[model samples]
Target: MSHLQAHAQSATKSAVRPEHGNDVSPHRFCVAPMLDWTDRHERYFLRLLSRHARLYTEMVTTGALLHGDVKRHLQFNAAEHPVALQLGGSEPDALAHCAELAEKWGYDEINLNVGCPSDRVQSGKFGACLMAEPELVADCVRAMRAATAVPVTVKSRIGIDDKDSDEFLQRFVAVVADAGCRTFIVHARIAVLQGLSPKQNRDIPPLNYPRVQRLKQRFPELQIIINGGINTLAQAQALTDGSDGIALDGVMMGREAYHNPYTLAHADQQLFAEDSAVPSRADVMAAYLPYVEAQLAQGTLLQHMTRHILGLYKGQNGGRLFRRHLSENAFRKNAGISVLKDACALADTHASLPPHEQPDDNLRNHA
Candidate 1:
């Protein structure tokens, strides 16, 4: 078998149903769907790191799927199995159609996006704004569940704006759960619909992890996965295993997973209890080169895929050189795998230098 196939099978081994007889959720260790970030190329790269961590597509709106290029929005590498397609729309019929499309396109799950606080999303009458209208959200969920056999999940903030009350969240979850949605990925911050930019909304709102845990406490049967501010594999493990008083069903890591992509290198072993050997950073790069080459031949721009790997060596020796080399050269016309090789070589070379012998900013600039 090819090394990639071997990695996939190895990860799947640990995903088997446990002795407890409860189905292990793919949600247990998910990488949050960030717009313009978690595309097919990035998902493919992440799969090489951990076979079992669930991946999500960026929010594709019903309008985009119905009127836009269907293939561009739906096509993905088969290696990204166990991946979900997150949809952005509140109209029941539109969402129902989208959910049907998602299942037909081979998505393992269909997630409704009710937590994004972006103005663009709000103007569409979807996203975190839906938090205020529990009944409408329920209708959307009901329609989606009717149209697709794949699990229909919802991702929402705990509350939105002045509706930041525990009772409000409870009512919302209860309504949606009654409508056949079994999983709710809660970003444990009250989305301030009016004052915050989308970027600010992610950070400015203080995280109410306790509130999410309490949500789980109230509805113990429904799968409740916590999102927002979780940064490391250790944190993901702790939250899912109930390191605190309440054991959540899962944890979703966002920017940290992207900016420090290698954080997932140990997920299969650490989170899924897999016994397979972990791939080193060098090993991951080597495995990914062939993919990059294939994409390059298929007319994908080298920069599109290379941009995702800039964080592969993040915080390691020679990491800056690795990033700098790619940032400087990957965008050049006709750039190919050679540029990536040179970047990896620079990282290796700088890491081999003695601490005192390593180049400073000035020397690195010239190098």
Candidate 2:
């Protein structure tokens, strides 16, 4: 067996939580509010892997909630408890209205997106541009907090463009803090709004962990969660040394969970030690088969579900074979649980590969 596969196997076995234990407390180690990639199905899949980690929904625009089907957009599985709904808007009223709707939908928290640097988001006068207007963000937070009993939080970049400095961040946090927001999830980087794509915004900007740590130290009473470029369990653990929590998206949740699912399995053991019993890859796949079949019955494409599992066997002996089989067979005319079974067989076959061979990408792109 390869070292990667050996590590995966050991990690999986070590991460398993007992079936009867239901008292494990949920922690703040969370998945970021990813756009388009963290839908209900995806959140359900992630919940299956880590029961105690908080999950975040994709960012829902205020316009969507006020004009669109609020329940359809906000509804999620009961299994996905401790979930936070991320809202995008600059209008305090619209945001408050959306927060009420979110609370009714049973979300545990409401988060304002002030870090996304996408052009579309900019056109809407929201996202990272709000960093330049701290007062507006404060109002939005105040409105949302008053509208609901659940905690209203902010997810923001350290700075943007010419404003990339400690002073800018300090001022930004101070203003938001004045509005009664006790929790801040800071993506530890500056966002270049004028030229970079949202994807590049997440990568091109350098991660300033020290600045974030200082922010936490400065505001000792606030629950500060550090995000950006956190991929491995060790990296997440490292951040927790100084911060209240760690937020990971594409790196650890989407890509890593897909590619190296064992990493997630291990997270239960290493990170949330009280509730460490994670299901094996085969068990996870088996549990998900019914959901996949149900989605297929509703005419949902296989790729939609299979895409989330592409990295499940990464670093295992048959990792490539498993990926190839799922990639090839999942979209077949009558594909069903058998396709997943075949993929699982391949994963089991290659379970002995070395760790270095594992295709785990360290960069998490949430654009």
Candidate 3:
């Protein structure tokens, strides 16, 4: 059986039901909800790499749904199933309304964005700053749960700024969970909202996996999945299998997955145990080309889709040439499917050569 087919078959057998409902969570392996990175096209591309990794949409604020283009923000390919929509806002009523829209749009889960440290998110009274106001977050969760049958989840930091303590985190989780949130995707770093930039916040804060592990131990009933600094499959396996003592639920990978998406190629078999042949980089692009063509026919710019695949050949031979070909050509006025095909040809050509015969390019070392 193909890995994707096997995953479909074994999904029910591997599901872990929470105390509240029979809904099987796709939380075991998830890709973080990055602001501009996890869009519909990107999610569809990643889906071709791994069928079991739960995908999340980039955060859509209540204001966007309430006033802006709703179809643009909520519409997604049905193939991207087990997908979640990450909403950014603090108002309970607005959140509830958006939650209803999420259900109407057929999203599998509704995740509140409580972990973004951007200045924009703070000005709007949402994101990581909400960790300090647990009661308000609980109200948001309560209202959202009432609006839809889909799972209402939260993705928050360990703590925010000075409130960076175990007790503070415990209180935040306790309050939100009390309002019907069962799964928590915790970024192990506290958001330094005062002096750091959002990019700095993702890197500067030292990761505290043990703190998150303790969170699972403290609230044994909640499904606690740890995020932040998880870069490898070995690391992902260690956390989920609890090799270090307390096994939480799962691991959410961010930048690593984006820069080297092929890392997820073995996730279905290794992480979910749906054993089958892993798809090669060529196999992935071959499957994705048809989707690219369809999107292009629908007026989507080729650059928007091509940019996501630039990192698909990150470490392989001719990877630099592949990126260069796309980066230089895909932005042209009439760029089409042939641009992608040519880029793939560059990667495939150099990949078949001996190491010594390959072109002398070391830029990937710095990339």
lDDT of each: 0.88, 0.75, 0.88
Error of 3 at 53 (Å): 0.2
Off by over 4 Å in 3: 1-25, 360-367
Error of 2 at 222 (Å): 0.2
Q: How many residue pairs clash in each candidate?
A: 0, 19, 0
Clashes of 3: 0
Q: Please report the TM-score between candidate 3 and the true structure.
A: 0.92
Cα lDDT for residue 71, candidate 1: 95
For every model shown, what is its TM-score relative to the native structure? 0.94, 0.83, 0.92
Write candidate 3's Cα lDDT for 1-367 as tens digits.
4444333335325432222123323587899998788999998888878877888999999999999999999998776777899999999999999999999998889999999999999999999999999999999999999999999999999999999799999999999999999999999999999899999999999999999999999998899988999999999888988896698788899988888899999887778876567898988888778778988999999999988888998878889889988888899998999999988988998887888988767553311
Error of 1 at 111 (Å): 0.4
Instruction: Residues 1-367, candidate 1: write the lDDT tens digits.
Output: 4566565445445433222115556688899999999999999899888877889999999999989999999998777777899999999999999999998888889999999999999999999999988899999999999998989999999999889889999999999999998999999999999989999999999999999999999999999999999998888878888787699989999999899989998888888877878887877887788778988999999999989989988877788888988898899999989999988888887776777876774454625
- Report the lDDT of model 1 for residue 126: 97
The lDDT, on a scale of 0 to 1, for candidate 3 is 0.88
lDDT (tens digit, per residue) of candidate 2 on 1-367: 4332333344334532223233322333677777767788877677667666677889999999999988779987666665889999999999999999998988888999998899999999999999999999999999998999988989899999999888899899999999999888888889998888887877888988878877777787777777787778787765664333432211223345444555666676766564435567776766677667777788877777887777776655666777777777788887777777777875775576576764443322211
